[model samples]
Target chain A: MKTDWKFILQIFLSFLKIGPATFGGGYAMIPMIEREVVDKKKWIRNKDVTEIFAIAESVPGAIAINSATFIGYRLAGVRGAVAAMVGVLLPTFIIVVILSMLFLIVKDNPHIESAFIAIRATIVALIVYAAYKIGMTAVYDKTTLGIATVTTAILFFLHVHPVVVIISGIFTGMVAVQIKSWFGMSIKLEKDELNVVKKEKQVKEA
Target chain B: MDVLVELFLTFLMIGFVSFGGGYAMIPVIEIEVSNHGWMTTQEFTDVIAIAGMSPGPIATNSAIFVGYKTAELPGAIVSALAMVIPSLLIILIIATFFFRFNENKFVKSAFYGLRPIITGLIVYAAIKFAITNNVIGELSWHTASLMIIFGLSLFSLIKLRLHPLFVIALSGFVGMVLY
Candidate 1:
């Protein structure tokens, strides 16, 4: 419970070590983070990992960084949070900046241009796959399916800003839930989320 | 100097609304990049490709790249900080006061709408990327090859369960050979 430079640096170093491993996406890094914070360091309990991650996912920003900040804040304070955030950001920042610099230098090469051309195509596919994966969890019921459809249509046709869409989504959810409750219908938020979390826990345990 | 501030403020705004994590953040970033004239859509696609191949969240990685592209190292640092600052501050505020914040009923209801919209946002990002990259447009040898690459990449991702890094590497090789 002592908030000192050493403790803050400890948080920073711990997350700095975990930073590079966040390669693919935030969800995949969950177990690795749990291993470090829960099992090895004992900074938090095994039980709390899921809750922290859930909150992290629900909030803004990358889940990896968010959860790291949460754990660090839980351990120390604002300084710990900043340390852990910078810790997580530092490795990826350097790697990306290096990659960017290299990219800038070689981007005009014919071979490199060809490679990136194909890579761009592949990136589109990756984004589509991400949407499919999210859609499976997000578009469960009729209402959700409708929301997803309408949202896409709105984006495509209206050309509205994404932030507006998001704020609208929140109000739409709240209002829809209220209306559904009035009509004696039950609504579930993120139905698959719990199941997925449970499956991840089971996999981790196994 | 102005660009650094612009980079910071832009990413900071992005950080605030970045629910549902990195993929959801893409469409917003794409819009901002184009609006700011920081890079061409083609260049932005390359950034996404590199970010995907890199070892971090795509959103954060892309922010660093965009920042660097715009105003060099200082821009990169400022942008990365802006992206995460929202998370740090929001988590700190919630953790201190609202212990069971996720379980709050209105928050639950809000996510009900937000979740599907995030899905929509990601879907839009894919469509937008495909359009900008000429993936969805007319059929040429180049477009055809790109489509082929896209199909194989998606198949490998969903069915083969290949890591994205591997998939990307293979696609780049295919690109090198084909192009």
Candidate 2:
């Protein structure tokens, strides 16, 4: 594929807008990403976002970065992927670097330290909230809930590395489906995407 | 240069292994960062918090932070690049080999289990952060306050249904004011 700079730049600019606009990280940028990618830019189909979420989440890294790369690659080959990746990361990089630098200067200040003290506590709540929100959709059945419970126990109690946990999850998911099939049950994977993933906040891949 | 290479390799390892969003990488990151004497557990929490409050992914944000601490702007730049390199390579390989593996039954079934495990991974991250940050280790006035804030944040997100951005922003405000 010939590297088209113009389209690559467009992809970059599109995600540049998305990077700094998102907050609270994780899947928080899904709706905004959809707006830039599928709705406004017309770069991809509506349903592809769900598939992208699965692929991005199944592998290592952030959903935001993974989807950016995946969509970028889909749009304009490797150039497109690079454009989108840089686009998405550039704004956040600049902002975070500035923040981190500023934090270095003020981290030990009594006031800011106190603020971080509380902020840290609230962050725990935020992560837990993420779990709760995603769990609502993910653990819809006993099998799924069982997977979640066992996984949680292992990660928490054993302090197992998350990569290992993720691998186990994939294995368990496949096995769970196979076991169900033994009893003549089948997993309807894609038919229900619209209902579960169509919403803004609920479509999180985290 | 030595430190930069270390930073690159360390985060490269993290980027490759991370799954279920950057939150799941917390434990892995903590160990690596501490082992390298980059930061203490307490300091890493600060990185996690900033990463959370910022836009983009936590893994990327952490890379930036660690990079900055090591070598300023250039260090930050390299670390950021290093963080995404593994995923970039993986995706490129996927694009080459399985351009459209989304419809594969084996993959779909794997995700069936993965979705909930991600949920669990995230929950584990939260609990670990709480313990590391001293929010849950010992119960006292400080822990009590932390619990109250945690409850309020949860309520705002779940019941009141506030957006995460607002919840985090509000938490920062309350943190500055109360704590």
Candidate 3:
């Protein structure tokens, strides 16, 4: 695909707006990204949008950047990737640079301190809201709830590292699936087993 | 050996270690910034606010903020790139290979399990941020009062589809007036 500079410019501006204005993190950017990219610009289809999101989450990078890179690469290949990355990052770079300068000048200023006090309180509320939104989707069943509750308890009480909990959760989930299969409750597992056995029989006959 | 290399490597390590995104990166960033005498605890809090107000992931914002503080425009570019590189490499690799195993049962189960764990980590992050910012704190009359406000605001924000920015602004107003 030929890289379109005009399209790249539009994307850059959109991301600049999103970067400066978005309150939370990656998840919070979704609605805005959808509004700008899918609904307004028609840069990608709905399924493509969903796939980008899934890819962003499963991968190890910042979700926003990954999504941008995917969408950019899809639209215009390497140049698009570069454009999107630069677009999303530019606003933050500018804002942070300015703030860093101002902070040095006012390191001991009383009003700046008060302003931060107020902002921090507000940020706390925003983070709580983000948690609630994610929880609604994630904690749907008893087993999932149990994992969340236990993970939270360990984090709060034991000061356990979150990565440890994440690893354990994956293990527990695998065990849960195994148990479900053992009890003949997993149709997917049964089907997989049946396919494997059929393949084994075919090989033996040949 | 140079200050720029030190700054770049610091951000690279921060990006590499931080999982579950922005909130998860806080402690690591704090350690790095403090260790290098780049920023103080209170100053770090301010940087977080700036990052929160801005966009493109908190870690990147912090890197930009910290880098610019240490050096200048060059510092900002280096730090931001360093923070992003690790994640970008991982994402690109995963994107290449993820589709081949899209329907694998174990992979599906693993992701399914990861959902709840990620949720828990996110929730814990919120609570920890609240506590660290002194939004909620050790039990006291003031703490209890703020907790009530917090709960009500949280409920309203969730149930009513209120714009979070507005809610955050309102809470800021309340803090300004009361605290």
Candidate 4:
């Protein structure tokens, strides 16, 4: 894609604004990013945004950063990617430095302590809200919902490690699919097999 | 030899190993911060709160905040970059290769298997935060029953398409008034 510095600059500034102002994390920034990228700038379509989200989640990076890199690359190129990444990160870098300096100067203040207590409590609620939003989109099917519910129960009640729970969920999902196949009710494999047969028939006819 | 380089390397290791992001990085961060005499446990917890509430990913923000505390602007830059580099490299590799094998059943199965695991991780994070932060610890009947309210708020959020910020603000108001 050809570089569009004007569009790239606008996207960069938008992400910079979002990076500092947003609380919680990547999930918290979604609605605002949607407003800017999808509604205002029209840089990408809503469906593309959703697909990018899925791709971002499946990959290793911060979802927001990954999305920015992809969108920036698509709009411009490598330079755009660098611009967007720096934009998203710079505000956070500056703010954290300032906050740390201030904290050093007033670490023992009573008012600061109480304010943090309040903020911490509020943050718990915010994290819950973020999880709830992500869950709504990610858990679409009944099977997925069941997995989510069971996993949540295990983690909440049993105090399983988060890594362990994630690993187990992966195992459980695979086993569930295998069991469904054994019961002659697996739609996924059947669809794949049907596609193979159709492709073979077309080849023979040609 | 230099404290800045040491801090940078430490955060780089943290970024490489800390899977699932945010809350998942907490324990590793606690170990490094306390081990290096960089900050106290209380300070670490406070930084986590600020990072969570301020913006961006918790791990990256924490690296920046803690690094700055330990050294200066250079420390902050190196730490933040260190925290981000591993994940960025991995994502780029995956993005390049994923589509080529998108339709492969084994790959599909692996990812399908991973869905529940991710859910479990999130659930585990929520519970740990609740306990560590005293959100649901030794509660009275009134406070204990607040789970029901949380549940309803979440339900309304999904079904009614309400913005999460509003829900968070409302919960904060309720906490301020009631708690």
lDDT of 2 at B173: 78
CA lDDT for candidate 1? 0.87
DockQ of each: 0.85, 0.65, 0.47, 0.38
lDDT of 3 by residue, B82-170 (tens): 98777666655555564633245776676566666767776776676677766677888766656666676677677877765566556
> How well is each residue in A1-206 modelled by candidate 1, as lDDT tens digits?
55589888888998889878777976666777788999899989988888888788788988888888898888888888888888877888899999999999999999998888889989999999999887888889999989998898999999999999998999999999999999999777667534455567878679
lDDT-better candidate, 2 vs 4: 2
lDDT for A24 (candidate 2)? 71
- The sequence of per-residue lDDT tens digits that candidate 4 reaches over residues A85-154 is 7787888777777767887787566656545444444444545655554454446566777777777777
TM-score of chain B as predicted in candidate 4 = 0.60
For candidate 1, give the lDDT of residue B30. 84
Interface RMSD of each: 0.9, 2.4, 3.7, 4.7
Tens-place lDDT per residue, model 4, B76-100, is 8888888877656665565555463
Per-residue lDDT value at B166 in model 2: 75
Name the fnat for model 1: 0.87
Per-candidate total of colliding backbone pairs:
0, 0, 1, 2
Error of 3 at A2 (Å): 10
Q: Show the colliding residue pairs in model 1.
A: none
Task: Please tell me how candidate 2 rates in CAPRI terms.
Answer: medium
Off by over 4 Å in 4: A1-18, A21-24, A31-50, A127-206, B1-42, B94-108, B111-113, B134-179
Error of 4 at A176 (Å): 5.1
> Cα deviation of A106 in candidate 4 (Å)?
3.3
